[model samples]
Target: MYGPLPARDPVFSRPLQPRVHPAGAGGRLRQFRHDAFDRGMSPLLVVDHVQSAGPEMEPLPHAGLSVATLLFEHAQGEIESVDSAGARHCIRPGDLHWTLAGRGVVRQARARGESLSLDALQILVNSPSDLKQQPPASFHLAAAKVPLIALPGSRLRLLAGQLGAVRSPLVLPQPLLILDGRVDAGATVALPLPAGWNAWVYALSGELALEADGAGTRALPATTAVTAGAHLADVQLRIRGVGTRSHLVVVAGAAINEPLVQHGPFVMNTRQEVMRVVQDYEAGRLGRL
Candidate 1:
């Protein structure tokens, strides 16, 4: 077991950087990625916040990367998603959509006419050498199916990985834990981190104080993310809601130290491999919707 480190100051405290991109017809995407803090947390590449919606969202294809998209906010409506594996699924708000782009696959996700808001977090976890050649796959976990733990003035939603004896049905090749926590003012919660995993906490709303391993607690404001160093292990976090109701997302994963190269949507170990992925996508290898 790893021992906790002293409470330290926040590695960073700032707002999310804004980005504009096109999605489908009549629909644009407002996305944010915390790239300046990308450390060698192997298997994990980028974390993105996306809000995309309109009257309708057309099908868009992506390739060469696996993604776990967690939808936290959305209007009452349905989402139609299809893959080259002939798999089709309908998703609702407060659901999670996971796609392993292995070698490659074509994917299309669109709002079912009734939805006008689609807000989500798209997590990019890099596939290692052995798993990168596998066929593409996807999984969905509806909102109703997600487990929620209630405490005094607080609630926790276990999104992925394990929380005590409760494990998420969505399995990944790599070990990761994703949880959403909410606490009313003055409420405190403690969550233990598994040994040998690097952790991160992103405050979504309100304000909170996070203390780990007896270290000094630090303030976390909205849109702010703190990355606990890869070397820090066996630490348990004590979180307190300071102002109003605080909401946060917790992500933990084993430290990955592999060489990484990324180009657009392709994540590989070398630039040559990224070029190959580009050629394959242009050649229609990933397939069409």
Candidate 2:
């Protein structure tokens, strides 16, 4: 059992109404960008919901950061990803891929065929200051390996981190929790959140309402995101599906609260460190995919 939400807890709700950006060649890929840092949601830097139709390939370069990609059930076809470390993976629907870009890493992903499509969320997490300089690593969690919790009218998938006794097999760079939740119409699900941790909830589809103990309920429509927590008391987020079935994601992590210097994909503690990472990548020291 968790305690009531603190009176001082700040809750924020915002719709995902950002301008759409074109990615990949010929505008085959569309992306909705959400910057958590700019919105005062720390630990999480960016959350991008990307959709692609037809063949597309994109090069990703990173250092001193962590990334997680979650694919939806409706996602079609497969994606082939190759990294500078000679690691390759085939990503399909309902799969979760986590990457730790410690020192530096170059990764490229492409649609396997023209007939396939993609709908997924690409999340960027800030690495701890101490582990930012380590070697790069990656982890893959197949759809079958993900843990699921079923309720009366709701099903929750633990994509990463822990929920009660349920835990994900994949190891993350920091303590974080990622949940994919589906709720039938009129169903309600209560999500327990650790004290002092920040939480972001994004509604993927359907109409929903989010209610905290002390904070009043807030409407959550499709493509909208809500953030809460960083309080001294434990909290539980109650999500109620309205009108139709609802699909959403819940991500929570303790705030890093450290200074961040970012240059494109490179994230470091200071400008000098970011410059060094950029130099290494430009000099071919980070390797090529």
Candidate 3:
């Protein structure tokens, strides 16, 4: 019986910094966290920007989570992934791979080609409590299927959910919006966020500024993220490219507000549930690739 918020301006939060970590061979990762805005980031447990140079990823098990990997424009070579169900996916630039590990699933990926370089965003979303015990599933969306919004000064790719008249073909267990795009220097784009939904903006490169309806503009530097939302009002976020062209991604979803217990790749409602999932994976009940 939830409804949309009343029409009003949006509220903005301060930027959240990312922690740089090493990934695969000669690869780098930037992980973002915002504990103070947990309510605004519910269902969104992890957001990682990864840069890899032709290294294979070890198989990892996950349960009670929905994961999405979106390749950016600078990505080179191909990423081939295989899952426990024996399903294989070949992801290219601008492609997306989404997995719903309701119960459990094991997956791994490797870079293909001589150049052996890859750039992508790996997002981990928590599943609702009710769907935590369901079966695992996955799908891949080619770059061609993603809708594009071409503006005078910017171009946005609808990776998931809806944006204006455009919508992504990839479907998930819950409603979520993801936009990846770039804005030209000195140009601005206005993005609409639904009432009661929480949104996070990430600066992939260059500098940018974000302004909400009634809030002052805030600077968003490279490799940083900022949150915005209003519990009872629909809001529009204005993003302006500063100094130089900017690349960014926007992720938004309604707050689940459920107790979240996580251990590594397992996300559940309680520690007991997580332990059970871990046991299932260790016993090979989750399956092998």
| The candidate that achieves the highest TM-score relative to the unseen native structure | 3
RMSD of each: 5.4, 5.1, 5.5
| All candidates in order of lDDT, best leading | 3, 2, 1
Per lDDT, the best of the predicted structures is 3
* Model 1 lDDT per residue over 131-171, tens place: 56778888788888788878898988887888777887777
Which 10 successive residues of model 2 have the least lDDT summed? 29-38
Q: Which 10-residue window in model 3 sums to the lowest lDDT?
A: 34-43
lDDT of 3: 0.84
lDDT of each: 0.69, 0.79, 0.84
Q: For candidate 3, what is the TM-score? A: 0.91
Ranking of models by TM-score: 3, 2, 1
lDDT per residue as tens, model 2, 169-216: 878768888899899988998878777678888888898888887776
